[model samples]
Target: MAQNLMVCQFCETSNETKYKCANCDLILCEGCKIKIHTKIKKTEVHQVLDLKEFSNLSASETIRHLDLKDIQCSIHNAEHCIIYCEDCKLLLCAVCLLESHRTHNLTKIDEMYHRKVKELQELDSKLCEELPFYADLEKELKQIKSESEIKEIITKQRENIITELDRLWVPREEEISRQLKDTAEYCDALKRNKAQNEETFQSHNATAIFTASGKLDKDLPTRPANTISKQKILFSETRIPEDTKEVFGSVLTDPKCKITGSFTLNTEDSIYKIKTFENNTNILSLTKKSTIKSFELKHSKCNTTSI
Candidate 1:
């Protein structure tokens, strides 16, 4: 008689199928099944069922049991909170939702999750992209602060230098003030005398008043008190003992860092540019300090012209 036979899943040997593996859905002979279940740790957890007991699942049992109920509402003794309250911003089950958040704006949890999460993610990405520009602005501000501190120090030193230069005018002013004191006093006395002469002229004694009116004398000042020279006041012709080298090295710079002002003359020159007229800047001198020689004269273009 010819008997039915089956192949063992593990050893590929021909034998009668004795059991089926639930996880792998494989048919195995008695010897191969025992060895596969016991010999390896990987196969040890696989479920083995009897051949007759093994069958495909029913259509109703195909859907998985996920326990989708929201257990957070269990604290309030309300069952299954699936709805989201938009106005109140809370998760509520059927009973608590109807009792407390019924009047508030409401949206399903699925809708809220999709909309709010997408918006939050977009905002996060934008901030991430803009972070570098904000960082660069902060770095630039710090650099400006450092530079301003150095400039402040140089400004204070320049103020001190100006104060030292201002001392030259003190004696000049004192001399002028002293020379003018007597003249000023005499002018005040003359005004008083004129007033007295006017009073005498209006007096009841006609002869005495006439004599006083004739004696009224006028005298002009011998020299003007406001005769200080323009050169002294302007200090333009004065030569400072400190040279440009000293001024650049220590005169204007602070100890921490060196700073320079706009259009600062850093070298000595015998020539200077002066604005004599509108749209006309003329060179007053033509020599350099190092070599005190004028520019070689350009030949005259006209017969009567001078260089």
Candidate 2:
């Protein structure tokens, strides 16, 4: 009986038919497949095309043969050259000198292979070291972006707080000012009413027999009481009075933070205070440094004052 024969694709070994590049018509053994064909520069571009796809090409396109006769030098037309320039990828005869390569240093293909392999290995090692740095940079950038986003959100929130506080202050301030003006007008009205009563009393007294016996001065009014009653009295619900603190209502601190107002008062008993605006809460209290002097009566009557 005859033994069955099988060819190797890479080493031309007929020992086994385990691996084959059928499209390229090459027989390869396992060792030669990895060590020889796969490592070669030219065959590296050739893929393992399926037989069906390869068969679709015409015969002229499928097969490529390098004719040694065509390997003549363009300069001298010499044949059978042993030397070749791997960097330039060209054949060179003995007559071809090194000066023709310009500044390029000429070397054998085997020397180039060793040099290239060593350099490629070193470059691969260096690239491996720098890969970690690239990953670290990417991570840092992501973290920085995340922190910036958070800060932006916080800033927006602070702006909103300021806006809200401003809204609350506008109308409230207008109303308070209006009330103050109305209070002043009411005080004036009271003064006028008292003046009218005093005039009526004086007229009645003049008609009477003995109205001003004690006041001999004829310049004084017939009635004993003055024509006008000053209403200067002001009372606070809390003994702790308000301050320039009220003006601070128009003034604002960080609305996102807390607000406190400070003030000084000139009165019979001087008062100094720092108060919280939100709850009308007093933070401090103090008394006058000197005695308060009394002033002459005005067109109105009421003595105590509060601010």
Candidate 3:
């Protein structure tokens, strides 16, 4: 098993290895150890040991032998990195140390490398612990966003309902306007006839007064019939059901209650004030003539009382 684990690093073909080169960090078979490894320039001084001796050394002893002399400085290309600056977290050559890191805390490069590796391990462990919390937070944010989108859709639906209501009421509004215009024209005709009759009454000549009075009496306009009462247009509001999910969407709570009914007071004067109570079952109204009436809605019928 030991022979299978160690392969000749120089030739990369021999599975059997009996020797190790610590300086070159290679496993060697006897043939490559003498023939190939020895032929390499400056490898003559490299420490070659027996496999048993190499296995006896500790990990620290092996690390201590690692040469950092050839590590080139990034700023000074020709210089080798000799130390590490803790404050700047950078590897520095002699020139870099003198130029910028003169007052900074410095340490051996190998020691700083081990310290940085330990810090990275700690940070990785902490990140692993916090990952689940961040994941839950992300889910909460997404849920809030989804709720906002649903609310926006509901708002758009409400606007569409209002627009449709306006469209449907156009013809009814036009009919009311036409009736008002006709009533105004009829009143204007009556006023003109009254003015003509008054001028004839104040005339000096008796013949003029007698002739104007007979013509005015024959051509006098009669009051138009009250056709508006027969063609009355009334609009009733729609009530919101207990659950609005079918029409709108899921609501947080039940909507406020509403009542729908109509009643007529026996006063010819216009209604000046109106108040409702008891969930709109009872209504109190005041007319322009200072007359008050109370109305109660029951069984789809209005019961009126004079006050």
Candidate 4:
């Protein structure tokens, strides 16, 4: 069997390589070596080597023999690049060299290509060295971002709690204020009537006392219907596990009213007047027969005695 020869670069069909053009970096068959390689423009000075000999040479040796004089200038398309300008970092033809880069540092194109390759290798090494530090910095930044998000969530929850508390309590506060005003007004009226009766009694006139007593009975203030009740608004906190995923703790409110004390009055007559004092610690009652009774709350039970 025949050995697997390298394919010709020019025709891309023949599998018999005989020569290699160092300048164009192409492998050619025997027929294409003479016909095709010669047809290309500016190949008169290109060093064509035997395929086996070219393969035997080191990479640096092959590059040294490679001709770059035929490389076209980008700006002056028809002219060929002869040198590379170190300052401008561009390939220049003769005309370009005279026009703009006359005083700039210049070198051969192959020398500059080697220098550029070395610089790229150094830059790649530096990037590899700093990659771990950048990765750690990115991780730290992400942790900070996560902490900030949690703080924002907690702050929003706090604001919502305050807003809801205000919504629930504002109307109740207004109701309490109205009850207080009404109670004050009722107390003032009673004081006026008492003052009038006391003045009448101090006059030492029996007729005046009899006439003022009927007026005082008519002017007596009635008790308010809607009295302010004692209220205790409490927030019962819920304990959360340390490992729980929840961001904040929760609270509960008891809706049912608690009965603190109870009383029983054994009165056969109808009890008309009832009054409580000192947070429901003491109570007074008056019946239609002018009978008075007093009670005191002790240990959640009521004890009464007649007066």
Q: Considering every candidate listed, which one attains the maximal lDDT? A: 4
lDDT of 1 at 229: 32
Candidate 1 structure quality by residue, lDDT tens digits, 1-307: 6674777778877578877765465788888777655676766655666777554222111111111232346447646657778776666788877687878998876565445434433433443444443344345433433333333334454565445444643464465455445444544554555455434422222222213423544332344424433231121222345553434223232223334332322235434432234543222333543332222222421111112
Error of 3 at 32 (Å): 1.3
Q: Across residues 1-307, which tens digit of lDDT does each residue of candidate 4 receive?
A: 9885689989999998888776676788889988878988988766678866664424324444343545667799899878888788677899999999999999987776555434433433443444444344345434433332323333455565556555645575676556555555555554555456445423322223223533553333444454444443444334456677544443223365757567555545555777876776454555545555677656655557546
After TM-score superposition, the amount by which residue 281's alpha carbon in candidate 4 deviates from its true location, in angstroms, is 66
Alpha carbon lDDT of residue 82, candidate 3?
Answer: 90
Name every residue pair that clashes in candidate 1. 81-93
131 in model 1: Cα distance from truth in Å?
A: 1.9
TM-score preference between candidates 1 and 3, better one = 3
Per-residue lDDT of model 3, residues 230-303, tens digit only: 22122233446756544532223223343546555454566676678667645455554555567665566555
- Indicate the worst ten consecutive residues by lDDT in candidate 2: 226-235
The RMSD of every model to the true structure, in order and in angstroms, is: 40.5, 42.8, 39.7, 41.7
Better of 1 and 4 by TM-score: 1
lDDT, model 2, position 276: 40
Clashes of each: 1, 18, 0, 0
* Best model number under TM-score: 3
**Mind sharing the TM-score for model 1?**
0.30
Total colliding residue pairs, candidate 2: 18
